[model samples]
Target: MGALARHWTRIAVTLIPLLIALLHASGALPLAALDRLDNVLYDARLRATMPRTMDERIVIVDIDEKSLAEVGRWPWGRNRMAELTDELFDRQQVALAGFDVVFAEPDDSSGLKRLRALAQGELKDAPGFAGRIDQLAGSLDYDAVFARSLQKKPAVLGYYFSSDRGGGTSGVLTEPVMKREDLRGRPIRFTAWNGYGSNIEPIAKAAPMAGFFNPIIDVDGVVRAVPLLAEYGDQYYESLSLAMFRMLVGLPTVEPGFPRDRFLGRGYQGLESVVLRLGQKTMGIPVDDRVSALVPFRGPGGVSGGSFRYVSAGDLVARRLPPGSLKGKIVLVGTTAPGLQDLRSTPMSETYPGVETHANMISGLLDNRLAVRPDYAIGYDVVVLLLAGLVLAFALPLLTAPKAVAVSLGVLAAVVGLNLWLFLGAGLVMPLAAALSMVLTAFALNMSYGYFIESRSKRELANLFGTYVPPELVDEMVKDPDSYSMTATNKELTVMFCDMRGFTKMSEKMEPVQLQELLNAVFNRLTDIIRDNRGTIDKYMGDCVMAFWGAPVETSEHAHLAVKSSMEMADAVRKINEEHREKGLPEIGVGIGLNTGMMCVGDMGSQVRRSYTVIGDAVNLGSRLEGLSKAYGVDIVVSESTRQLAKDFAWQELDRVRVKGKEQAVAIFWPVAPADRLEKPQQDELKTWAALLKAYRAQDWDNCEVLLLNLQRMNPKKFLYELYNERVASMKLLPFDPAWDGATNFETK
Candidate 1:
C-alpha cells in the first residue's frame, strides 16, 4: 500500500504539469499577452531590416495633405485625374499607372449636371421646348470630356470589394491568378461591386486591364499578407499590383501554383509561387496564395523622406516636372498625410503609408525577394507542445528535484534556440512563444505539485530529524530513502568540538537563575551559527558543543566548513563575554578544535535512545584538541587535515605532540586572518615562526630556540610563539623521537 501510494504521488507530480502545458499550447488557456509580445518582437525584427530604397521600377504618387491643399479636396474632378493620367502616359511614358483609391461614384458634374442645365435652359424658353430639348439630347453625355482623357491613356482604375452590404459597388472582377479547383474545399470569398464610380464605358475601352486594390486586414489590424486572387460572385479578380505587373510584361493571363495537404493532418494550401509567362519570357513570383506577401517598409521616415519621388497633380497640370521623369515607371497614386486616414497601423510602424505597402508588395513580386509562412507552421507548434508535455510527464516522475530543474532549463533553452534559428537563419517564423509557454508551464506545475503535495511529508521528516541532523542533510536523505538509513557507518568527515574555557568558575560567581539564562542565550547563538555553516550539531555537553560535517549531506568542502564554523563559534563566545562583563559577571572564553578523518556518523545508541553522532578515533581527537586549547592559550586549534583545507587563511604551526593514548604525533596550527589582511611585520614574524617550526621538526634545538625567541620579541602577543617556545624547551631536554610524526594523539576523550 505504501509503495502504491508513493508511485501514485509521483505520477500526480508528473502529470499535472503535462496537462497544464498541453492546455496552454492548445489555446484552451489563451495567453493574449504572449501573442502580442510575439508580434512586437517580429515587428521589431522587420523594422530593423527595412529596405531604405524602393526598387527603381516602382514609384508612389503621394496624395499628401500638401497635394490635397494644392489640388483642392479628394474627388479632384475625374477630369483633373484624367488630365494627370494623360500627362503620365503621353509626356512621361509611364509603363503602368495604378490608382490605390477607388472611384465608386461617377462624376455628377460631367453627366447629370450638364443634362439638368440644358433642360433648365429649355424650360425657361418654353414648356414644350424643355420636352423637345430632352428628346434631342436624351443622354447628353456630360462626362464626355473626362471620358475622352481617360480613353487616351493606358490606365488601370482601382475599385474595392466589401464583405458588408453597404460597402460594395458595381464593378467587374478580372480573371483569377489561380483557379478555385486548386484549393480543394477551402472557401475563398471575393467582393463584387454593384455600381460604378467612374465612366465605366470609357474605362473599359481605354485600360486593357483593371484590378481591385482591396486589402484584407487580419483580426489584429496588421496587414502582413495580401491575397493574390479574390472571387466576387462568379467572377475572379487580381490585385492592382498583379494586374499592373501583367500589363508591364504583356502577359494577358498568369497562373499561381498552390499545393494541398503536404503537411500534418490539417488541410493546408497556399500559393507555392506565381508564374507569369510574358511573351517569350517567364518570371516566378514567390508569395503565399492565402495571405498577402510581406511588405518591407523602409521605415517611418521612408527612403529619403519616405524614399519615393512625390510629383504633385498640380505640378503635373502645370507641366513643372523636369520632363519625362515618369517614363517607363510603374506609378502608384495614394495618400500619405495622416489626416487623410489612409494610414495603416503595422507591426513596424503605427502610421505607415498604405500605398507604400502596396508598392513593397509589387516590388517584392517583381524582385522575387519574398518571405513566406509555411503551411506546416501550425502543425509544427502543436507537435512541439505535445512532445514537451509528454517528456516532462515521464521524466519528472523518476528524477530528484534538482535534476528535474536542470532538465527543464535545458529543454527550455533548446526550444527557444531552435525557434530563433528558424527565424533568423531560414527566414521561417516558427512558433516560439507557444513552445516556450508549454515548457515553462510544465516546469512550474510540476514544481508546484512537488512542493505542495510531496514536500510537506518530506518537511515533516526533516523536522523529526532536525535535532540530530542538519535540515539540508535530512532533505537529501529523504530524497533517497534507500541510500540512507539510521545505521552506524564510518566515513571521512571533519568534526569540531567547542567548550567554554571558564564556565565552571563563572557559574560559581553567578546566581543559579542567571547562570541558566546566560548559558541558554550563549548556546542558542552558537548552535545557529554552526547550522548556518552547514555543520550538524552532534550534542551539547553542558558547556561543550560538538558538531560535524559530511554525515547526512556529502560535501567536498566539509573540512573547510568545519574550520570556518569553529572560528565563528569562538567569535560568538567572545561577544557573550562582553555581555557578561557588562553585567559585572566573570568573563568567559571558548576553545574550538577541528579534525578530519574517518568516523561513524549515524544513529549511535540503543534503539529507543539512538542519537545521530560521530564515534571514532578522529572524533575523540577533536574533543582532546579543544581541551588542549587552554594549554596552548589559543581560541581555535585545527589538525593538519583541517589546516590543509584552510589554505586560503594564514596559519602558524604550533607543535608536534602525542596525547596520552597514541604513540603517533599530530601537527596542529592556529588560523589567523587572511594573508592579504596581515601586516608586513606580522607576516615577517609568521615567517620566522615557520622557520622555528622547521628547526624543531628537524630536532635542531638551538636554532629552534633562537628563531622562537626572535618571533616572541617581534610579536609579544602571538600565542603560537609562546607555545612553540615551550615545545622547544621540552624537546631540548628529552631527545626527540627519530620516527616522530606531526600527529597529535589524544590521551583522554
Candidate 2:
C-alpha cells in the first residue's frame, strides 16, 4: 500500500500542472465561472443568514412606476429637474447632488418663445416666421436658467464613455481631471470617446465639476467595480459617483506624489493613495492610483430600499409631499421606465435603476464603509493556487477514495468560506476563483490519471464481464471488484427486463444468418441505451435482456434512471423498426419492465460459468412485467416502486392485477411522453384515465366506471381504460376486500 501510495503521489504531482494548463486552454474552467459560483453562493448565504447591512451608507431616490406615472413621461423638462436640484441643495441641505441623468440640451419647457419675446420686446410682434425665430431664441436662453440652478450647489453631472467612433457626435468634453503629464511612464492606455451628455450651455456652466457615470460592468453585466478616473485624450476625467463623493466630503485639492526610482525603473509613488488637502488637515484617500475602486454593493438590490426615493414630479409641483422630506438629501433625477433605456440588468433584478447605483456609491463613501481588493491580491491568489495544488498533490495519493474526496471537499469549502469571511468581515475581496482552480486542477489530475493507471485492472474486469454486462457497469465493477464478489445480500435496486415481441414468428421467416445479425444489432442498441443512462446490464438470455441498478455502484437516482432508460429503449426500438422497414428486413418491437425493491445481487452461477446478476421476487416481477407488456399492447410497463422515483416524466396507471403466482395485487403504470408532445385530446384522455384509477383505488366503483367510460370514448386504444373496465366488472360480482391495497402483484416469472 505504501509503494502504491508513492506511485500515486508521483503521478499526482506530475499531472497537476498539466491539468491546470488543460483546463485553462479548454476555457472550460474559467475564472468567470468561479466568480458566478461565488455570487450564487453569496446570494444563497445572504438569503439564509440575512447579512447585516454593513456600515456602508447608501440612499436611493427611486424613479419607480409610481414616480413615472405621476411625473408624466420620462425625459421631463429640464426646468422641473432644476427644481429637484434646488430642493436637494436648499431644502434637503444635501452635501452634494449628483445627476445620474445627463443634461446635453436646454430645457425648452420654460417657453423659449417667451424668453425671446422678452429679450426682443417690440420686435417679437414682427411678421414673417417670427414665432420660429422666437422658439430658437427661447431655447438658447433657457440654457442659462438650467446652468444657474447647477451653480447654486455643488453638483456632479453624469456622462458615459463610448467605445464607438460615432461618440464624437456628442461634442467636446470639459477640462480633464488628470493630465498626461501626471501619468509619466505608466503602462496605462485609453481608447474610448466621451459621449451622450445634456450639454446645454447653462447646465455645463453651472456645474463645472462633473464626472462620467459610466460604470465598468463585467461581461456578465454586474457592476462590481468602478473606475475612479479615466484618461480621455491627454486629460483624465473622474466618474460621476466619485466626483459626488469627493464633493460630499468637502472638495479638497489633490497634489500629485513625487516619482520614486525602483529596481525595474523610475516609478511613481503614491499611486495607490491620493492626498486630500483641506484647510489645515490632510487626509490620505486610498485608491488604486490607476483610478478604480471596488464597489461594495449592499447585498442584492442594494440595502433594501436603496434603489431610490421615489417621488413624482407631479407631487412636487402639486406640493403634496410633506415638508422637510427633501430638505437635506442629495436627490438624483433619473428614470426607471423600461422603455427609457436607463434600466440595467443585474443578478438581483432584471430592471435595476441605474441612477440609484450612484447614490449607493456616494452613500458608501460618506459612511467610510468600503470594500477593497488590496494591491497584493493577485500575488495572494497565485500563492493560494500553488499551495492548494501542492497540498492536493501530496495528500490525495496517500488516502483512500472516500478520504480523498472528503479532504478535497473540505479544502474547497475552507477556501471559499475564508474568502467570503474576508469579504464580509474585513472588507477585503480576495480572488476565490484562483484558489478554487487549484483545488479543481488537483482533483481532475488525480482522477484523470488514476483511470489511466488503473486501466489494466479495469480491462481485466471488462474482459470477464463485457460479454454479459454493459461496458459502463464493467468499468464500475473494476474500480473495486472484490467488494462486488458473488454474495446474497438484500439491497434496494431497480431491475429492468426487455424482450422482443413476436420474435418466434419473425425469426422463423428470416434466414438464420440474418436473424443473428438483426438480434445482435437490436441488443447492441439496447445495451448502449442502458449504459447511457448509467444502468448496469446484468445478463442476456436469448432474446431477453436483464439489467439492474445500485450494484457495482450505488446511486439514489437508480430507479429514476431505470424507468427513463426503459422509455428511451422503447423509443429506440421504434426508430429501429423504421430502419428495418427501409432496409427490407423484419420489423421488431420491444417490451420493457422496471421494478424497484430489495433484492440479492452479486456474481451468481457456478465458478466455471460465473456471471453477475440479481435474484428475488422483485426480479421475478420485472420479467413478468415484460410478458404483461404484450398482453396490454403497450411497449413499457413499470411497477409502483419505479413510478415513485420518476419525478419528471408523466405516467398512467395501467392496472391493479395479481398475475399468475402472486397473492397481493400490484399497481402498474405506463410512462407517457412529455405533456408538450401529447396532443390536447390525448392529454385530456390521460387525465380522465388518471381520475378513473384514483376512483378505482378508493373503491368508488360508480365514479370509476363513469370515468373509464369517458376515457374509452375519448381514446379507445387506451389499455388503462380496458383494465379499469375489467376491474369494475369484477367488483360488481364479488365483494371487495376493504384491506385491499393498490399494489399490483405478478404471479408469473
Candidate 3:
C-alpha cells in the first residue's frame, strides 16, 4: 500500500492522456477539429497512393477558353452542339460519348422560330420571304437538329440533383435506376435529395440515357466522393460515373452487397458494396459508411495530370483534330472555362475540373482501385489508438529521455507505415488522423509530465543557472548537478566585452523611455546571437555586455565560438543602424573585444546578494581590449590568444600593445571576415599590412610610410592606415632605441 501510494502520481500522469485519446477514438468525445484534420490526412494519403498514369480509355471534350473564344459563348446554338456530336461519332468514331452539361433551356440563338412568327404576322405580303423562310427552317431548327443527332448514338446526358430543400427544380427527369420498393426491407442508407434539375424534354427523350452529376461535399467544402446511388421522392437514381460504368457493362442490374452475418442477427448490416449483375457475371463496387466511393485522383489535377486527353469542343466542331484521335474512347463533354463555374475543390487540387473527377471515378471503378473506408474503420482506429497509447503511457515512465524519444518515434512510424500499407497494398483507406494524433498527443503529454513533474530538480537548476549560461549549457549542467556548484573554480575559457559607441551622444537627443527601448532592442539581438553560438552571458553593465564561453558547458571550440559571436554582433549592429536610418534616427555602432585565458567563474558578490560571474586578470584584459577599440578606430579587437585559437577566421594585425597595468606586450588583431568569405584582394591587402608591420618593427620608417600610403589609396576611408601613419611619424620624431620592440603602450583604459 505504501508502494502504491508512492506510484499513484505517475500512474495518473500516464492514464490521463490515454483516457482522453480513448474517448476521442470511441466517438464518445468527437472533435470537429480532428475530423477536419482527418480530411487533410486522407487527402495527403490519396495523393501519395494514387496510380498517376494516364488513362487512354477516357477523353474530355472541353469547352475551354479557346472554345468559348472561337465558337462564340456557352450554350452556343444547338446546331453547333449537333455538329460537335456528329463530328465525334461520324468522324472520330468514339465508343461512348457523354455530356457533362444539361440542355435545361431551349437554344433560340438561331432565331428560326422568331423568323417564322415574323413571316406569318408582319412579313406575310413581303416579296419572297415566306418561301425563303421555309427553305431555312430545317437547318435553323437548332434544338431539333441537336435532338436528332443524339437519337441513335450511345450518348448519355448529364443532370444534377438539388440538395437544397427550398430550391425549385424544372425540366424532365428520367426514370430512377432502382425503385424504393427494391430496397424496402434492406437496412441500407442512401443519400436523399429534395429536388432535381434534369434535361429539357426534347433533349432528354432524344439521348439514349441520362444520369445525375451531383457530388457529395464533405463538411470542409471538399468533394472527395460521389454517391453511387441517391434517393429522390422514394426513387433511387444513379450517379454519372455509375451510369457510364453500367452502360459499358451491358446495363447491369444494381443490387446491395450484404454480408451473410447480416442474416444471423447482425444489428445493422452496413452497406458494404453495390453489386452489379449482368447475366451470371457480378462485380461489387465498394462504398463507405456514407454510401460514397472515394475519388481516385490519378495525379495533381486537370490537364497536367494527363489522366485523360482533353480535346477542345471547338476543335471537334471544326473537325480540326486528327482522324480517329478519339476513336473507341469514352468521351465526356464538359467545360473548364472559369465563367461556366463547373470547378470544384477536391483532394487532388483546390480548383479541379468536375468533369475529370467523374472520369477518374469511372476509371477507378473499372479497374477496381477505388480506396474505400470500410464500416469497421472506427473500430480499427480505436484499437490502434488504445494499444499504442497504453504502450507509450506505461513504458515512458520507466525509460530515460533518449529511450523514451526512441520508443515514441518508433510507435509513430509504425502507425504511419501501417496506414500507408493498407492504403497502397490492400486498397483500404482508414482514418489515420485519430491514431496519429493520439500517438503524438500522448507522447507530448508524457514528455511534458517527465520534464515538469518528475524532473523538478532540472527545472530548478535551469532557473538558477539560466541567466549566466545559455539554455543549452544549463541543460547540460542539469544532467549531473553534483559536478556543478556556486563555488568558484579556475577554468580556461574565452570572454567577450561589447560596448556601443556614441551611445551617450545618441541618448542626449532621445527621451528616457526611447533610449531604454533602443538599448533593449539592441541588447536582445546581441544576446540572442551570443547564446545561439553557445556563449554564456555574464552580465549587462550600462551600454556594455560581458559574456563568456566554455565554463558551464566545456567545449574546446570556446575561442572560436567567442570570436564568431563577436563578428556576428558587429554585423548585427550594422543591421540595427540600417533600421535606424530608415526610421530617421541616428545610426549606432558597437565595438567588441575578445580574450582567451584561465579565469575564476562562480556565483560571487557581497554577503547581501550574489550572482554568477567571472573574475581574474584575464577578464580585466578583455575589458581593456574593448576600451582600445576606440583608440585603434576598429569595431573589434581580439587578443593574440583568441586569434591563434580561432584560426578558421580571417584576421588583420592591429598592433602589439601593452595595456594599462600590464608590462607584457600582447599582439591584437581585428577580425576581417570568415575564412570562406575572405577574397583574394583582402589577402593581398593583409600581406601588404604584414610587410608594413615588419618594416615598422625594424625601424625602417621610409618603407613603412610608403606601405601606409599605398594601403590608404586602396581603402580611402580606412582609419587603421591613418592611425599607423601617425604612429610612425610620431616615432620618427623621437630617437630610435635598437632594443625597442615597437609595441604601443596604452597608459589608460
Q: Write the per-residue lDDT of candidate 1 for residues 370-454, one digit (tens) a residue.
A: 6666556667777777777677766765667899999888888877777777766666665566667667776787777777755
> Against the hidden reference, what TM-scores do the models get?
0.69, 0.56, 0.64
Ranking by TM-score: 1, 3, 2
User: Which 10 residues in a row give candidate 2 its minimum summed lDDT?
Assistant: 50-59
Among these predicted structures, which one has the highest TM-score?
1
Q: For residues 129-243, could you state the per-residue lDDT of candidate 2 as single tens digits?
A: 4666655654355556566677857777777776656655353365575677765656553334544453555577677777787776766676555776776665777778777
Look at candidate 2 and tell me the lDDT of residue 131: 64
Q: Model 1: what TM-score?
A: 0.69
Candidate 1: stretches off by over 4 Å: 1-53, 69-79, 104-145, 162-210, 228-238, 249-314, 367-486, 491-494, 501-521, 528-534, 549-561, 576-587, 594-598, 631-633, 637-749
How far is each candidate from the true structure, as Cα RMSD in Å?
A: 7.6, 16.8, 11.0
Q: How many residue pairs clash in each candidate?
A: 25, 32, 0
For residue 362, model 2's alpha carbon misses the true position, in angstroms, by 1.2
Q: What TM-score does model 3 achieve against the real structure?
A: 0.64
Off by over 4 Å in 3: 1-8, 115-139, 165-167, 184-189, 259-269, 459-477, 480-749
* Model number with the top lDDT: 3
lDDT of 3 by residue, 586-690 (tens): 888788889999999988899998888889999999999999998888999999998899999999999899999999999999999999999998988999999
